[model samples]
Target: MKIYSSIALSGVAALMATTAFAQGGTITINSFGGAYEEAHRQCVIDPFEAETGATVQIVTAYSADAFAQLRAQAQAPQFDVIHFSGGQEIVGAQEGLLDPIDPASLSNAADLYDFAKSNLEAGEGPAYSIAAIGMIYNTENAPEAPSSWTDILDEAYADHIVLTDISNGYGMLGFLMLNQVQGGSLDDIQPGLDAVSSLLENGAIIVSTSPEIQQEFAQNDAWVAPYASDYAFTLRNAGLPTAFVQGEEGTPASFITANLVAGRDNDELALKFIDMEISPEAQACFADALRYTPTNSKVELSEEVAADVVYGPDAVAGLLRFDPTVIEANRADWVDAWNRTIAQ
Candidate 1:
């Protein structure tokens, strides 16, 4: 059965009433596991539940595994929302697995940055999702901070760096950065594969799970990790010596696209949730607590926080946004080449 049908959205009054009654309906959300998940609970899910009186059932998995599960259940999706990277979103949209977003229903559409709007347009032909900001490191590790991607690979920080396993999204992004640095096109990222292989050869430890990385940093087992800007903020707040550095080549950006499941029973409620997810208040809370760059242009962030986010004018200017279409089309070849190169 379609999961959307399960959502009851008779009207705003009903929504309020359902909330007041503590009706105990659940909205399943899929996300990356561990600290990132915990951060979401603190920043988004908990507040959303308190306000709407809806129980949020979170499902955690690696992005690739999550996408595979979503595709497997295309006829009857399980989760109300799936948080995925831009490449996965592009592939899903191209395959007709995602529903287009209606801007009119989303009151916070007016607040979205032009880049976020444009990114949504290019990915799903409408504002199907908000731009999810990512960054490389946390400030506690490097107080002065290296200003570019080159710094991550520098001799000074070599042994001190910790990176995600090859299966993770950030690892893939690291590959993309290597490809760019080695003058390889995003369409053919073999150079990136070589770079990562070199790192692995050079004794770069791969921590596949977010919790492990968080713990490592917390215990001072490692000083730096490649992670999302929001996640980096989370580590910082947890008293880890971490900081995000804008790559000299440019800061890299990614997104978490929203999709309406096909044949879901409660399409309206699903849409309403999507609308609420993009609302100014929700976005502001996400930014303030999670340290992610809010896509909504209307939300005003303080100078201190704004300086750390990836969407600010200077940050955006320094960002090198990858083209998802190219990545999606070439992923298989890229993965195959990566496997062969890294295996050696």
Candidate 2:
């Protein structure tokens, strides 16, 4: 059985009731749950429902679990739309699990930045938000903020670091980035393995969930971690004395995209929903709420909010993205290497 969290919005109930007498009652969206899901509800779902008088049901799934569910229900998909972070979108598209999107169908498509509009893999949909991986440290506990990826493994932070397993997206990026920084490529992750193994030997704590990281920080057991910049902001806003910074080398970034599930109902509505996701209003809301960089070129964020996100063309231009195609092809091998050498 697949595990997924579900929520039917309040207004959605009324819409569902009305539609029960008319036609299909809801549109299903699959996404990562918690604060990120809430951000989607506020920025896109609520507004879309208000405008179209449609109810949306949100189902939570991520990474490998998402692909598992799709494969299990290959004949008939449960969700109308799906959201993917990074190269996973390309993976799903290649497997024929996702339907190709028409640029002409998206009203807001022309307004998106080149990166957001990029058809990374054929049939992969439009990108709606940008997130960057970086180091987060407790300003009060750490003697100094970590300025580089290597800092987490430094002797000073040895006992106070929280490391993520390879299964997590942030963990994968962290591992890949460390490998690059230490003169290893995706094809050769031995340097990353050797480095992380050394750190683990020094007492670094390993965790898989975001909440676990938060718990460690709350308990004052961890002083620093490698994670997304938006999550770092979330921790600080939650009253943790936290600061986020990219490594001295550069930052690895990802685009969160929305795709229409293959053979699911409601293509028109799904296209509209995706279009609205990149609209100026929805984009700004996401940016203001979670510091997600808006994909819409027309959306102009204020200085304070933009400061936290990777905003503007120059910043976006400077972002280092692992080729989704390359990452997709070798992720499993990298994970295996991580488990064998580092987890040992």
Candidate 3:
């Protein structure tokens, strides 16, 4: 069955009444633009609308912009749900912008992998998000896929590599990988920053936007990019000779956190969506279409795809998981250090 069913006329009437009483008429979701957005609509929204009968309106924005908007609306929440990285979710939770989730109602919660559940909880008792991590390289040119971060920095990859912009959360994880390769710890990222600066100096292009990264790699022969495992999978599915790597140091991992807008009008609905998100159907569709590791334990991945996803048993063992708390606290410092040291 498709994930979401269309709302019946009777259900639509009930939703309309509920919305009217709540002072809002629709559920507005803000998400990262491009293919991910499309996948979300297909896998999450369409089904939800069919089943619940409430209108789902998607608002597209860059990750930074989405965060900014969420903060601006904190006093009077506008969006019902916000799809953001775990790091951003940590910040939101700290600022009292997100609501705690109830796992009891989420029937498929048991299906989530242990790591995904633990990462979501972060020891605070509630999960903020679930995510997967991995690397992408073009198979057409690379021929032999790289199995670690060090491979990206090899002189052989010079001038043919593209990396995510360092400002965003995914980019930060990429930076963490470079740090791991350089013998630097996430506790002190200066060494990693230096390594990245060196790579840029040697010809790594800074791809600040996902679309730019996608286009560059898809149209041109930009053979390698350090990206979210899910994104890399999306590229490969599109018939690009792209291959994702499970770094020797293991893969770096992150989550797609759900931010609770402080004054959300549809708190119940928001929670419902979160519950559904972790459902077997939703999680499966998300993993199958977007190449993300399912946080839902019930959702199993194909053996081939599982090998590339960060949370895959073998792959997870090799990953250096980034702590959202640490990232949240030091984001400014990291950014400043990156800007000052990178010279880019």
TM, every model? 0.72, 0.81, 0.77
User: Residues 166-284, candidate 2, lDDT per residue (tens digit)?
Assistant: 78878888778988888988678888889888888998887898888888898855898988888877887878877777787878888788888889768888787898898887888
Candidate 1, position 32, lDDT: 69
Full-model lDDT, candidate 3: 0.67
Please list the C-alpha lDDT of all candidates, in the order they appear.
0.61, 0.79, 0.67
Q: State, as a TM-score between 0 and 1, how close model 2 is to the true structure.
A: 0.81
Off by over 4 Å in 2: 1-26, 151-158, 201-203, 323-333
Rank the models by lDDT, top first.
2, 3, 1
Q: Which ten residues in a row have the lowest lDDT in candidate 3?
A: 120-129
Cα RMSD (angstroms) for every candidate in the order listed? 6.4, 6.1, 4.6
- The sequence of per-residue lDDT tens digits that candidate 1 reaches over residues 197-303 is 76667666667777777877777556556666766666667777566655667556666555555555555555556665665555555566567666655566777
Q: Judged by TM-score, which candidate is best?
A: 2
- For candidate 1, give the lDDT of residue 178: 56
Candidate 3 residue lDDT tens string, 242-266: 7677767666777675544557668
